[model samples]
Target chain A: DAGITQSPRHKVTETGTPVTLRCHQTENHRYMYWYRQDPGHGLRLIHYSYGVKDTDKGEVSDGYSVSRSKTEDFLLTLESATSSQTSVYFCAISEKDPQETQYFGPGTRLLVL
Target chain B: SQQGEEDPQALSIQEGENATMNCSYKTSINNLQWYRQNSGRGLVHLILIRSNEREKHSGRLRVTLDTSKKSSSLLITASRAADTASYFCATVVSNFGNEKLTFGTGTRLTIIP
Candidate 1:
């Protein structure tokens, strides 16, 4: 384990409802990221934070928003859940290094019903 | 998307057989990484190969990067049934603490015992 934990490991929600996934890391890494994994799309980045209060959008940031209030917690929120938004959400952290090798959490599986 | 494309979307082999998965990307990258994901879990980083390096080995895993061809290959020797999982190749482009990784659809490897 990379000292990372995701809340609500499995979730089922209806359409148009809001959902939030939380990622917490104790490694005190400077980089944290959120990604969604689907059948054919592989893992697409949604958002990332370089440090507390510093964040950026990733390639597939649509329908997703993220916030990092502190160094250890990164939150991903879906304003309104949709069937298309159902995916396995992963949180990864990497130390400040050249390679940027990410260590991932156990993941949270979201199902939009 | 400039994401890596993995060949042989699915592979099946008996235990003890070697497996090779190839990935080809469309653009220049600073580094390439391999990840493995088991059912109902998050992805685990396997290895990383820099653009400047040609080959690297980690135990039974071997990774080769050929920047000239924009390609990389992962070789697993003496595979076991426990090794069955999905393998992905992610390419990292750009730096400056805002790194983005493009991932391939992935190869589903089934090691039959």
Candidate 2:
């Protein structure tokens, strides 16, 4: 599993509430990414971190945020959840090299109602 | 707005048969990668083929990249019921780091026993 883990494998919450998901990795990879997958959408990049405190928005970054304060942990937060945000979230890590392969975490399934 | 798009949104095959999926990308890329995901699960890395490389193989999987056509193909030979899953192709452009991956919509494969 590439030593990657995501907490709260399944979660259900009501709209307008705050939610946070955690991704931890044993490997000290330099890059971490958060993505959301839904039917017919495959996977859409939400946010990515190149280094601690250095992050960038992806194509679908609205309503979500990410923080990487340490090399081993990356967090995704939803300031105010909405039903449209319901999807499976995955965290992936890769080496600093541009051509390195990415390893994914088990994923967190979030449902907002 | 997806950089990569896959054809045949779904595929069905019997055990011991070969399953082939195609992915087309809109722009030039440095490399392409394939990934597999079981229903309601995270994605697993499969194979990667660089732009300079035409084909690659790992176990029962074979990947072919055609840079001129901006496309790639994944073939799982002698597939099994366990191989039933969704397959996606990701492309890495000329980005400096690991932020290069752009995933396709994916193809859902059903392996009938």
Question: Which candidate leads in DockQ?
Answer: 1
* lDDT (CA) per prediction: 0.91, 0.91
Cα lDDT tens digits, model 2, B39-111, are 7778999998998999999999999999999889999999999999999999888865544688888999999
* Stretches of model 1 off by over 4 angstroms after superposition: A97-99, B95-97
Native contact recovery (fnat) for each candidate is 0.70, 0.64
What lDDT tens digits, residue by residue, belong to model 1 across residues A11-36? 99999999999999999999999999
**Candidate 2: residue B34 Cα off by (Å):** 0.2
TM-score of candidate 1 chain B vs. the reference: 0.95
User: How far out, in Å, is residue A109 in model 1?
Assistant: 0.9
TM-score of 1: 0.96
TM-score to native of every candidate shown = 0.96, 0.95
- Candidate 2: residue A89 lDDT (0-100): 94
lDDT string, candidate 2, A43-108, tens digits? 888998888998999879999999999999999999999999999999999987535688999899
- TM-score of decoy 2: 0.95
